[model samples]
Target: MKTLTRKEFIEQVGIGAAVLFVAACAGSCKKTAQGPSSVNFTIDVSTGNLATNGGFLVQNGVVVARTSSGSFIAVAATCTHQGGTLNYSSGSNQFVCPLHGAIFSSTGAAVSGPTSTAVQKYNTTLTGNSLRVYS
Candidate 1:
């Protein structure tokens, strides 16, 4: 067998490294681009009476009262996994993603995986009859 030159060996290794990098990036890029599906409308906050344990979907987010402590919290209704919108479950008092059954607490904590990230939180303040949520 003939001895391989240093330049030839370096060139082969470089080509192999480039192919590995491209394949790795291709797989991860698809995941990063994934997000919640879009909804065409927004929820009217004024109609959301904050009297009891009422929750409402305003625009693409949700405003909910976790307790009688007057603690109102807002979070994105969009799922972090495959871009599914979550519905407010008054019975369970949690956000339920219909797509894959992922659950989240009223405070946006991830109750389950399938989605390893928490729902995006929104800033909220009660403005008279309307709940103002920052975009």
Candidate 2:
């Protein structure tokens, strides 16, 4: 058996801590929607869940929501706090993550939740039956 000197012990501990930190950060290093790079898609609002207010659907990594007042808003579908899937709350006009109760505003700004990072927001334009979501 061998006993480590103070210097050796400190070096080993430091290395171990560095390894742990890297490992911990590796998960966060994954790509976030981060306003996505470029988003341009068309959704049919004449029918389906989008036809009425208080309805939402996820498309191309973005969640398209219709507010209670019949307004359209689009944001990243993933929660910034822990990458959980987000759901639209028409009553609160917010996005919520079921996994950790993280909340985000309709504009994708994290608020009163575990995360402070805001998700991506997309511009939307409605032309009759077609709703175009773009960056």
Candidate 3:
């Protein structure tokens, strides 16, 4: 193999770095381009899993929870305090962030913790066996 001169080596390294930077930027831009927005989806609750009270599921960055009365509620799954992902607690009827211990009520209201801003809530409707969650 032919050895690269000092100047040729620097040029090749610079080109490789530029290519890598462009590739990284392209991948990140694709993610940021899709800003947060309302999402609508249909789920079949006839299976009896989500149909029961206290059932919950997270999909497409949103959390869908079934209340004790069998009512469905949807909200953003990310904590408002530090953008930490939240998990639903069936026993406490709230969403808890493991990162900072932030807690949000079932209605997405910031109940107790460092965050005072409530998470974005979506409206949910049940028609027969179909459940739709939307903004």
Candidate 4:
């Protein structure tokens, strides 16, 4: 077997590394091309005086309040299966996506769906009357 020179071996390795890095970077960058980078926005519900089982969508994001229990939960309004916009529906105690009728409960549980994946949920904490959600 012919062994490669040290310089030749290093050159091949470097080229392979560069190719792998570029491939990895390309995959990560593809999602950004569709639009502006994914963004996170905050909702201020401290003053809403919401009733039991009340909920609202903030800047297209959904937050459900278990008013009788004074607890709140935040979930991404985007559907995981098809990326459709989801809305909180009081009639069903769940989030409903209009495009494909995907349903998720307030805790981001998949209630029913054309989808098997549930909505992405945020960490919510009640500081006084304010509900804060984070990654």
Best by TM-score: 2
Candidate scoring better on TM-score of 1 and 2? 2
Candidate 1: lDDT of 52? 57
Extract clashing residue pairs from model 3: none
TM-score of each: 0.54, 0.74, 0.66, 0.56
The best candidate by lDDT is 2
Candidate number that wins on TM-score, 2 or 4: 2
Which wins on TM-score, candidate 1 or candidate 3?
3
lDDT of 4 by residue, 97-126 (tens): 789888888777777878766666666766
Tens-place lDDT digits, model 2, residues 1-135:
899999999999999999999999998865554657689999999899999999999999999999999999999898887788889999999999999998889888888788878899899999988999999
User: Model 1: per-residue lDDT, tens digit, 22-131?
Assistant: 99898675433122234223233444454555555445444344343555666776788887888777666777889998888776778885886777666666756555
lDDT of 3: 0.80
Least accurate 10 contiguous residues by lDDT in model 2: 29-38
Candidate 1: worst-modelled 10 consecutive residues by lDDT? 33-42
Checking candidate 4 for backbone clashes, the offending pairs are none
Give the alpha-carbon lDDT of every model.
0.64, 0.90, 0.80, 0.64
Model 3 agreement with the true structure over 47-94: per-residue lDDT tens digits: 755878888877888888887777888788888887888787778888
Clashing pairs in 2: none
